[model samples]
Target: MAHYRECPAYDVFAPNCPARLVLERLADKWVLLLIDRLSAGERVRFNQLRRDMAGVSQKVLSQTLKRLERDGLVERQVYPTVPPTVEYALTELGATLGGTVERLAQWAESNMPAILLARQLYDQCGE
Candidate 1:
């Protein structure tokens, strides 16, 4: 593990480094938003997710869902309905993560004003 870090890779955030990949996924707002929605305990259809998360494009949402599904944080179900219904729900792992992510969301909501103030102060300092 230490040897991998000392390899002097050109990109510090190489695939060998798990933190980089996790940060990349967590950095995407859509991913967190999807997690938030799925935490609501109801199976969500594709169209419903789109409506719930306003401004998310179909491609982006699909891509995010795929990533979450791959990570074992979400479960995808396809029913043998007339139109072949597809729904998304959080897995046990996802539910665990949802609790942490929800707390993070709450922290952000409470501290946004302070964060903006800090940003404003930094900008005034001219970098």
Candidate 2:
């Protein structure tokens, strides 16, 4: 007799599915921005990331980075120095998402005008 292993299928739409938790993280605006910014494949300092993201508070950035680190999508390295220099970069798993994240960013930029027009039409219709 031969035995085979079974792989479980996950559906994000299901509340109890672990994939839903991942989807929640990926759907966060800050998480998306951080992933896109780090997609450049360079290790960036916390302050640099803050400046690049503009409008994100330091506290929020710290929290988001911690979450990303916990998720295994980002790697944080701390160098022993005066104040302890810290840098963040995407992990191999995170790098796999870079292209997809970059494409999503491009799509948003490319469709902004159309999106604005649609929003204006919707507001005018007052539906």
Which one wins on TM-score?
A: 2
The sequence of per-residue lDDT tens digits that candidate 1 reaches over residues 6-70 is 44653645656655666689778998989988998889999999999999999999999999999
Poorly placed runs, candidate 2 (over 4 Å): 1-7
CA lDDT of every candidate: 0.88, 0.90
TM-score of each: 0.82, 0.92
Q: State candidate 1's TM-score.
A: 0.82
- Give the clashing residue pairs of candidate 1, or none: none
Candidate 2 lDDT, tens digit per residue, 1-127?
Answer: 0111121467656555677678889998899999999999899999999999999999999999999999999999999999999999999999998999999989999999999999999999998
RMSD of each: 4.6, 5.0
Judged by whole-model lDDT over C-alpha atoms, candidate 2 comes out at 0.90
Candidate 2: residue pairs that collide: none
